[model samples]
Target: MRFMVMVKATGYFEAGIRAGKEHSAAKDAFLHDLQDAGVFQSAEELLPSSSGLRVVFPPGGGAPAMQAGPFLPEQEWIADYTVIDVDTEDEALKWVLRMPLPPGQGEHVIEVRRLASGTACALDARAQTMKADLQDQLSLLHP
Candidate 1:
């Protein structure tokens, strides 16, 4: 199974602060283990929400609007993530437990999510036709 392990953003994360050297070393070792096990696919850190943007799509096929961020309450943001192709959820959890967090954050959260492959869902005939049409439209934009 493939899983994405997400490190939730805290205030420090939004401020672009990271954990200490000891934590980093431990994390490095943990990443090395995951790589050696051949489960590691990619790891990345996201910029703070303050530096990001949101695209809001209105109801009933209305035009989308763009909004800049520094969005509130921090908890809704992700700071970093790792994608792994592991054997089971249990194995993924074990790896997650080994990841170190920035100390003194009061409360820290990590989330694990299973991603859907092949356009994220099983497509019916109509859905497949919709996808092809969407792609055809996009190709017109690019080509």
Candidate 2:
């Protein structure tokens, strides 16, 4: 199973304050532990919302709309995420418990969610089409 562990954003993150050395070291150590355990797949911190964009689709089949960000409701914003492949949810939870808190925090939140895999859903057709299209594009670039 694959799980995504997301760190929620705060006003401090929006201000672009970097993580303190101690906090960074702690996080690095945690990541190293995950890698050593053979569960870590990927992890990264996101840029603030000011540098991101949101795409909104219309109710019908009209064109999609794009909005530049600085999106509010800090609780809804994501600061960073880690992806891990583990045997079960319990194992994933154990890994999350070891994650370090954000630097200089008042309160912070982390969310964990399981990801869908393989062709086990109603959207499998669409997903396969997109995958084939991507492969075709990549082949064109390489050839």
Candidate 3:
């Protein structure tokens, strides 16, 4: 199973100021361990939401409205994330629990969600059977 571990926090354009570069060593060590275990796929740090844009779609279908960040509700900010392939959710949680904390960061909120890899990856037998049936119907529609 592949899990996406996200680190969520509320901060401004200056999240790095208090986070401190000194913690990079600890972060690097954690990454090294993940790589050594052959579970790490990738990791990334997201920039402030102010650099993003939001598209709001109207009901029933119409032109969408575009709004630029910084968005409100600071609680929605996700600072960074990592993708890892593990045997089970418990194993993934074990790894996430060891993730190093950013300097000056108080409590961190992390979210772990399994990726929908493919028909054969994480889907149950029933889901796979349904997907196969759907594909058969779609093929007939085009042919």
TM-score of every model?
0.77, 0.79, 0.75
Q: Write the per-residue lDDT of candidate 2 for residues 1-143, one digit (tens) a residue.
A: 98989998888888898778889999999999999998887889999999999998999789999999888763388999998989999999999888998756668888999988863343345677998999999999999
Best by lDDT: 2
| Tens-digit lDDT track of model 1 for 1-143 | 88999988988878877778987888888889999998887788899999999998998988899988878873388888998888889999999998887677657889999866654443446778999999999999999
Off by over 4 Å in 1: 119-143
TM-score leaderboard ranking? 2, 1, 3
Look at candidate 1 and give me any clashing residue pairs: none
Clash pairs (backbone) in predicted model 2: none
Model 2 spans > 4 angstroms off? 119-143
Poorest 10 consecutive residues of model 2 by lDDT?
118-127
lDDT of each: 0.84, 0.87, 0.81
lDDT assessment of candidate 2: 0.87
Q: Which scores greater on lDDT, model 1 or model 2?
A: 2
Q: Which candidate would rank higher by lDDT, 2 or 3? A: 2
